[model samples]
Target: MQTLSTDVAIIGAGTAGLAAYRAAREHTDKVLLIEGGPHGTTCARVGCMPSKLLIAAAEHAHHASHNGVFGVDYAAPKIDGKKVMQRVQKERDRFVGFVLKSVDSFPAQHKISGYATFVNQQQLQVEQADGTQLTINAHRIVIATGSSPFVPEFLKSAGDRLLINDDLFELTDLPQSVAVFGPGVIGLELGQALSRLGVKVVMFGASGSLGPLQDEKIRDYAHAQFNQEFYLDSAAKVEHISHQGNSVQVRYQHRDKGLISESFDYLLAATGRRANLTQLRIENADLTLDDLGVPVHDRYTGQCGQSPIFIAGDVSNAIPLLHEAADEGKIAGDNAGRSLKNAADVRAGLRRTPIGVVFTEPQIATVGLSLPQLKQRGEHCYAIGEVSFEDQGRSRVMHKNIGLLRVYGEQGTGLLLGAEMFGPAAEHIAHQLAWVIQMRMTVPQILDLPFYHPVIEEGVRTALRDLNHQLHIGPEMVEKCLDCGPGA
Candidate 1:
């Protein structure tokens, strides 16, 4: 048995926990990061960083298969799934190794490979894999336990039939057909990845609008590109599964369309995710859970309203994006390091809204408030913008004219409140809008800023000009309407 103490103890070395470890070092001398799983599941490890590499590789194959429009026609290249999986592991290993080595700079007092059990407030019993027990005490704690994939109850006790994001790369061979549940980011990203790799994917989800967090235009545009059959009002209830020689048969009943049995090599349960907080012992930590058993905390600093205890990452009921988790964690780290919570409303300087990116081909990127959501909330907002991919010189050069650039604003101010771009470099535009929306920069202010021309960035300027027109109205609003009207 061993004992350790730190100024702040963080559990889970995922994105939030890792970022928090770095941020805590700014205010405190000692920060401890704990992980139950090995260091292979974080963003730098098996999450976005690695999964995206596989997705991109698969996309290259897709582009090769459909080279006719791009003027480079070619037959479908042989896809070596085993080789692709090998590269996936190889790349994930290299990147994750570098990240793990960087941890030495923070001097983690104990990076235990064990599940932490809270014996009491600020005290924990760490159970190592080798059956060794260690005691740890801390002045403050941040529960960054992250999230686990939510598998439906019926998928339980079934082996190899149902899979999650982590299990995809482990596949030995590609499935002939795949049935995907939920149109969330992970599911869509993975579904598209496999679909691009020539998997016949059928998506079943209750949401009429896919990627509900994104702009309506982007969502509609992507739905057009997916080329998959949508069981749109269908909530699948998996009744049973049977193995017939070599094929796996799935018996499911769609709520809207009655009973149906389908045979696929595999089924994926990507319905969503819930916090991995059960082993953390919430009662022992004296924490409260919402209906989902996720720790209830203030959206800002992630403080639970309990003294010296805060939460971060998916467990904190945040939006569960890596960047969102990292941002909230900086707040939690500051809260944990402080003796009296001296932080100035930790989310004060934080961006007022979130940015989301769906990593599908002709990818979707959106930041700030969506128009429908704004209308639902009855916000005094109106969006004026033009889709400008038609005029981009670079987009023309690439022959990748498949998406839109739309920006939204306050009713008449032309203040750029939100933006969504979904074409080449759409993710780059999303990153830019995150800052634009955060600072509440108006179109004029953004336009005045230096922007190089003959670039896709010009799309922003064009949208801004149209927004500016809507703002000023050219001092001829009634005159213009009157000329257009029958009375005129």
Candidate 2:
């Protein structure tokens, strides 16, 4: 057995872990970064980058097939499944290589290749691949082990025919058919992409949820828009899942067709993800735990019940986005490193305004506080402003007119609070809204910003104008206003 000591020890060399290491190094050189698996971020390896690459290919195919509305005629797009997967895999490995390069640049002495288990609040036991054990006594510890996909117990019956988002990228060619068991971000994105790429896809959700939209109206609008291209049931009653030869069979109650059985090349379990905390033997960590057995920690300071131990990233379960994980990791690492010099060095870190985007056709985005979050806080003094892309000039010009955008503002102050959108250029609009929300701008202030004529952003101006009216600060919206030009 070998024993070592460090000022700070961070688990999992992922996005959060790498960020933590960099942050901790700023405060102390006596920091150790530990990894049990390969070095690469979830975004680079399986989550964001690869998925977007696949989505890009899907968009190209979809646009080619749907451009007839503009009198632009093209033969049906030929989807080379093998070439699509080849590009996805090739680009995915390139992204992973960049991450590996970054990890390689770090000092060798600071990196440990082993799986770590908690011995106590301040101690860890790591088992290396070479059959050696090392005991590490860290002055402060940061847990950033990230998360793994969660498969429902019943889905396991599909045996080897089952797949997850991670497994999907490994395929040599796109499957002929897929039955997606969740309509969350991963399911919707992958399911729709597959459908666009000439694969048969059916997506099912346990609850009446579509993407990340909180507004029921927007969810319904998005549900309809997606169904126009592929089969989706936001709330499904599935009967059984079984392995049939090389394929997976799904039996479910269809909304209009009654009970139905469908066979697919794979049963994708996109249910959800759970924090990777169980294997650490947290029971022996001597820390307060939540109902789900995760450490009770303050998200602001990343401190676990005033202990020297900190939690960050997906393991923290605050927000699973990559940017949030990076922020939390920096906070945890900074606090952990500074605590070595003085325990009082712990302080709340910068928390950015919440912004999320789902890269689906039309797209789905949420900025700042969602409507459900406001209601959860027992706040009622707010007004909603809405715009439909179905008639927006730019959207209509592009023949991409489908979906809705809703902006929220404080009733009295007229301050922009948040927005939920399922519309064209939602990803771009969400970034603009996020900036204003972070700056604490009002509806009128946002309207004062220049909106180019006949652009998709004119739709945003329309929503804000409506919000201003609802706040009693601007004139009532005029339908097809001649003064605001065609789209406005």
**Reference-based lDDT, each prediction:** 0.71, 0.91
**What is candidate 2's lDDT per residue for 258-366, written digit by digit as tens?**
9999999999999989999988999888999988888999989999998889999999877899999999999999899878888988999999989999999889999
TM-score of 1: 0.85
Q: Please provide TM-scores, in order, for all candidate models, with all chains considered together.
A: 0.85, 0.98
Model 2: lDDT equals 0.91
Query: Which parts of model 1 have CA positions greater than 4 angstroms off?
Result: 1-5, 104-108, 212-214, 228-246, 250-261, 340-353, 376-380, 388-397, 449-453, 471-488
On lDDT, the candidate that comes out on top is 2
Supply the TM-score for candidate 2: 0.98
Q: Write the per-residue lDDT of candidate 1 for residues 138-213, one digit (tens) a residue.
A: 8788888888888877654345677787787666667777777777777778777877777777676655557644
Which residue runs does candidate 2 get wrong by more than 4 Å? 377-379
CA RMSD of all predictions? 5.2, 1.1
